[model samples]
Target: MTETNPTKVQLVQVDPELEGQRIDNFLRTFLKGVPKSLIYRVLRKGEVRVNKKRVKPDYKLQAHDEVRIPPVKVAEPQELPSVKLNKVANLEQYILFEDDQLIAINKPSGMAVHGGSGLSFGVIEALRALRPEQKFLELVHRLDRDTSGCLLVAKRRSALKSLHEQLREKQVDKRYHALVSGHWPASRNKVKAALRKNILKSGERMVSVAEDGKESETRYRVLQSFEQATLVEAFPVTGRTHQIRVHCQYAGHCIGGDDKYNDEVFNLAMQEKGLHRLFLHAYSLSFMHPKTGERQTLIAPLDPQLSQVLKNLSHA
Candidate 1:
C-alpha cells in the first residue's frame, strides 16, 4: 500500500498485494521513474536484497520476504539517463571529469555514441582507439547523436552496473537547455502525455503522443523569453523515446532545428540565426558516484556555435 515515490533506500515487507510479482517488473512499477536496464543491473548485482540475500530478476515475491531497495539516481532521455563548451568548435579535448570509475566528455553534435547504421566509428569507438591500455569502456546511458553535451563512459563493469541501477531509479538529475519556437507562457510548466515510437519505411525513428503509448512527462522552466522564441530548461521526468522533443511539440512548441519534429517556418528563422543543429543541449548532469556513493555534478560548457546563436538572438 506504499504509494508515494521512493527517494532513498526502502525496506518493504511483502504483503498479499505485492506477492507473486516478478522482482524486475515489481521494481519497474515501484520505481516508476527509473529505466529498465538499470533495474535489471541492480537485480543481477544483488543490490536489491531480499531477506538479506540476492535473488534473480525473475524471482517471484513471497508474502514474508523483506525487500531492501537501494537509493536511486535519476537522469533520463527519450532514451539521457544519461558534454561541453567551447574552443575550435569541439576540436579540443573536452574532458569535464574523469576518475577511476567513469569518464565524462563534452560530446560534440553529429557524433554517434556507438558505430552502426553506415557509420564506421563513433565516440565510444574513438575513445577505445585513444585508450588502448584500458580494457573496458561502455556507455552508461545514451544521448542523441545530434545533441551535444555530457556523456558518461564506465571504466569497469562494476561501475557500469552501479550507475545503471541508479539511472533506472531516477537518482541522477539531468538538465538540458533548448530554444523553442514562439513565446512560451510563464504559467505553462509541464507536459504530461503518452508517447509512442514508430519507425518509418526509411528507417527513421519518430515519436508522437498516442493513447496506447507509454506514460511520459517533461518538466520545463522558462529561462528567457524572446520575441519569437523561448529558452528553457528541460527535465524529463519519465524517459520515453524522444520524450522532451515530443512533449514540446505536444505543447505546440517545436524545438528549433529539430529535423524530425520541427516547424518549417520556425526552423528557417532559426537557421537564419545559424542554428544548423538541434537546439537542445544536455548542459548538466548530477548523479551519485557508483564507487563513493557521493553526489557529483558535471557541467558541459556550450560550444562556440551554440553560444554564438544565443548571442545573435540577444542582439537581434
Candidate 2:
C-alpha cells in the first residue's frame, strides 16, 4: 500500500509478509508518522477496522484482511542516523556470524541494544542505517546496555517469529562469563532465587531477591580462582531481568565493577585490579536455526579491555 490523501481513508490488505502481526504494530509501519496515542485512539473508537469489522489493537492481521486506516496527519520523517559515524561504521567489524535469515554480533558494552530512553540510536538503529534497502530487521533478543555478548537480529518476520518460539520452548542456550570476588564454593554451583524489580524515582532500575518475586535460576561453574577475583561461567536457566547480576550478588560474590547490586568495598578492591565496568559478558549462544533447522552455536570472545583486566588480576 502506498501513501494516499491524508484526509481520505485508506484500505490496505494484509499480506503474508505481515501475517500474524498485531494490528497496532502493523499500523505503526502502515501509518508512519502517526502518534502512538492517535493510533490507539482510532482503534479504540472503532475507526480502524479489519474485514469491515472493528478489531482491537491486539488483533492479529491475516493475509487478505482489509484494514481501514483513518486519515491522520503524518509527521515529518525523523532524521536518519549517519552511517559514517565510527560507532555505526565499525559495527560491521564486530559481526561474528551472518546468514540469509539472521546475524550474530558480539555487542560492545555501554551501547544500548535498541534506541530509546534518551538514546538517539543504538545497535539496531545503526544496523538499519547500514542496510537501508533491507525490508525488515528486528532484534531476536536483547542484551543489557552494559552486558556485552552475542546479540541476534532477524532479517525477516518469519525468522523473528521462529526464534521467539524456540526461546519460549527453552531450546535456546546462552552462557555468560562474569568476574567476581568472594568465597565462591564449588558446591554452590547453582543459585535458585526469586527476584523483584524496583524502579527508583530517579528512573534507575534495581533487581533484588524477594520471596514473592518471579522464580529464577542460574547454574555456575568456576573457571579460575584468585585472591583478588574469581572467574566463573554462568548459565541462566530462566531469562529474567538482571538474573545473573542479582544472583551473583545473592551468592555473596557480587560481580566486580557492577555499579548496581554491587558491594562498594568489593568494587573499590576490584578497581585496583583494572576492572572498571560490569565484569559480565555473554560468551556463547546455541539454538536451532530458524531457517535451516540445524543446531547453531555462536561464540564471542572477551573484548581487549575485559581480557586485559583478567590479566591484570593474575599478576596483582
Candidate 3:
C-alpha cells in the first residue's frame, strides 16, 4: 500500500485485504504519524468520507470503496532507537508457540504490547520490524506492560476474527499467577464485583469498584503462602480493564508489587524481598484453534527473577 501524504487531500481505494477493517484503523495505517485524535476529529467533521458519504470510525470498508482524507499535518516517521531495535530482535527467543494462524510469545515484563502512550516501540511494532515480509500481524489481546506470558498475535484476518469471537463468547480460558500482599482466606474463592475505568487529570488510567461499573468476575485459588504474601491463580471471567488487579484489591489482598492498585507499604516490603516488578504473570491460555477445531492450550513459565523472589520468600 502506498503511503498517504498528510499535506494533501487524498482519495484512496480500499483493497480486498483491508475490506473488513474499521475506517479509523485503515486511516491510521494510511496516514502514518497522524495522531489518533486528529483522525477522529477529521471523521467527525466529515473531512473523511467513504464512497463520498460521511462514515463513523467503526464503519467497515468494502473492497473498492473510495475513501477521502483531508489535509492534516502529520509528524514525520522517526527511526527507532538502536537499543529498542536490539531488544525487539531478541523477542524471537521468547516465542512459545507459532503456527500458520497464530503465534504466542512468553512476553517479557516491562514491554508494552503495542506502542502509543509515550513509548516509541512495543511488542507488535518490534515483531513487525523483525518480520518485515509479513503483511498482516496484529495483537489478539493486550497484556499490561508489567505482566508477562502467553501473548497472542494473529497471522491472518480470519484467524483474528475467529479468536475475537471466541473471546467474546468466553470460550477462551486465560489464567494468571499472582502474588498478593495478604493471607487470602480459604473460603474466599470467588470475587463478583463491578469495575469502572477512570482517567486521572494527569492522563493516567485507573480502575475501581463501583455500583454503576460493568459487571466483572474472578476466581481465585491459593497455590502457596508466605507470612506476608500468598501465591494464587486468578481466572478472570470478565475481561474488563484491570479486572484481576482491582478484583484482588477489592478482595482485601492487593497484588504484591502492583504500584497502581496495591498498598505502598506492601509494595515496599515486597521490594525488600527482591521483587521489583508487578507479581502478575499470564501463566496459561486455552482456546479453540482458529484454523483447526481442536482445543489448544499454551503456557509460559515464570521468569527467573520472579521465581527467585518466591524462593527467597519461601526461605524467609
Candidate 1 structure quality by residue, lDDT tens digits, 223-315: 888777999999998877788888998899999989988899999998888989998899999999989999999999888988888877852
Each candidate structure's count of clashing pairs: 20, 0, 0
Task: Return the TM-score for candidate 3, rounded to 2 decimals.
Answer: 0.83
Model 2 TM-score, all chains together: 0.91
Q: By descending TM-score, how would the candidates be arranged?
A: 2, 3, 1
Model 1 misplacement above 4 A = 1-92, 314-316
TM per prediction: 0.72, 0.91, 0.83
The total of clashing pairs for model 2 equals 0
Compared with the true structure, all predictions reach lDDT values of 0.83, 0.90, 0.89
The list of candidate 3 runs beyond 4 A from truth reads 1-19, 22-28, 33-84
- Per-model RMSD to reference: 12.8, 3.0, 3.9
> Can you write out model 3's per-residue Cα lDDT over 136-196, one digit (the tens) per residue?
8999999999999999999887788899999999999999999998789878899999889
Model 2 over residues 1-316: C-alpha lDDT tens digits? 2333488889998888789999999999877778799999999999999999999999998989999988887876566689999999999998999888998999999989988889989999999999899988899999999999899999988899999999999999999999987757878899999999999899988998999999999999988887767889999999999999999999989998898888899899888877778889999999999888999999999999888888877532
Off by over 4 Å in 2: 1-5, 51-54
